[model samples]
Target: MVKELDEKIGALPDHVGWRLWRASRAWQAEFSAAMRAAGHAWFSEARAGLLGHIPRNGTRQSALIERSATSKQAVQQLLDGLEAEGVLERFPDPRDGRGKLVRYTRKGLDALRDGDRIKLEIERDYIDRIGRERFAALMDALRSLDAGPADASEEASVPE
Candidate 1:
């Protein structure tokens, strides 16, 4: 699959492939800046949203950290800021009083919802520019790439 993708990429026009790669980073910066300007900055929006999905008061902070793919310290920092902003609250885990559980406040849920709406709007605009067929193909290709086996693991396991 990697070889096939490499061949396809190799066949792309130099300018097109280069611009596609460059545009991804450029778009990320633009989107992050827009989110910040809209008072939804920080990578924790997705993390907070995921936390919201879990049963409140029953979910543990460690679970949230794992699902968010962020370090415990980083999650704690984001949680602290969110708590200060009244977006979420931390409580002692009933299962283990020493452990903490995080839950989103009404404000936090609202913020997450608003940020998602904005992201959808931005994506819609980009898709509109790309046109439906092209956008569909691009999305399908990206999803296929994402679903493929871990290339890094395969490479590491190969005989030297």
Candidate 2:
């Protein structure tokens, strides 16, 4: 699958292909560092916004765990820790009293904004390094890829 994908994209010059690969890794690392520097104790914050992308009212902890790609125990630990820090508040789900709904406090929102700012700065740095035209082209390519179907077998074949 990788060979096939490579062949498809191989129409580009060799240096461009190599540069794209390197830029992908650089952006991934930049985002990872930005997430860490945001001082979000939970990996959930790293995954999405303060309130999370999942619907708070209807979602379960298991759902959050699955969606966030974290273990249930890890998610619980993070939730507890964040609650202790007053970053998130958990309330009884109005729809399901037995279930809890998690949402961010003002502090959590502020922290998320800080993380977004860091991400923006990283992106700006990349644009400055690569120039706006190249950056825009790269973004377009990324969006195209993102809109494509997920190929699990192909993804599994890739070496980490």
Candidate 3:
């Protein structure tokens, strides 16, 4: 069944969006596998998205919802799971008494370090396979396509 779907999709017209989606999917799988190998067996591509939006000092729950481009309920569910796993904690927002701020636990910070290191390693692998010049061109082209990434930048989340 999967092979049949693959054949059908493969027969369809190829375009930039299709290629990008396929590439992203492949990369995500590789990243998840790498995380598991690095002793973070609970890590996954979805959790990575949640983790990426968290800053060192922490951000409000509403801010996480906005930055992650996800529903408030969805963000809460993710937060609840992470909290259960001891990866993060939620605190009452001082500025807004009714609001909540989410911050990483010690475990999460350690995982972030591993994530950053793994990301760099992945980039080096891509450079070796595609050549540095070609990889640089690819990055430039990708950046040109979008206005810019979301206000997802917190600090040290993305590799230099």
lDDT tens digits by residue: candidate 1, 1-160: 9998997777755685687679776666666666678786544444444554456343688887777777778778777877787878889988898988877788766666776777688779878899888988987876655555655454344211
**Candidate 3 residue lDDT tens string, 1-160:** 9998998778767799899999999888988898889888768788888888889889999889999999888888888888988889999999899999899898888888888898899999999999999999999887655534565443524342
Please provide, for model 2 over 6-96, each residue's C-alpha lDDT reduced to its tens digit, 9 standing for 90 to 100.
Answer: 9888676568669878876776667666766667545343444324544533356556777777777778877787778786777887778
In model 1, state the lDDT of residue 135: 82
TM-score, ranked from best to worst: 3, 1, 2
For all candidates in order, the CA lDDT equals 0.69, 0.68, 0.85
Return the lDDT, model 1, position 62.
85
Q: What is the C-alpha RMSD of each candidate to the true structure, in Å?
A: 10.0, 9.5, 5.6
Q: Is candidate 1 or 2 superior in lDDT? A: 1
After TM-score superposition, the amount by which residue 16's alpha carbon in candidate 3 deviates from its true location, in angstroms, is 0.5
Model 1 scores a TM of 0.63
Q: Give the lowest summed-lDDT range of ten residues in model 1.
A: 151-160
TM-score leader = 3
Cα lDDT for residue 132, candidate 2: 96
The number of the candidate with the highest lDDT is: 3
Model 2 misplaced stretches (Cα beyond 4 Å)? 1-60, 150-160
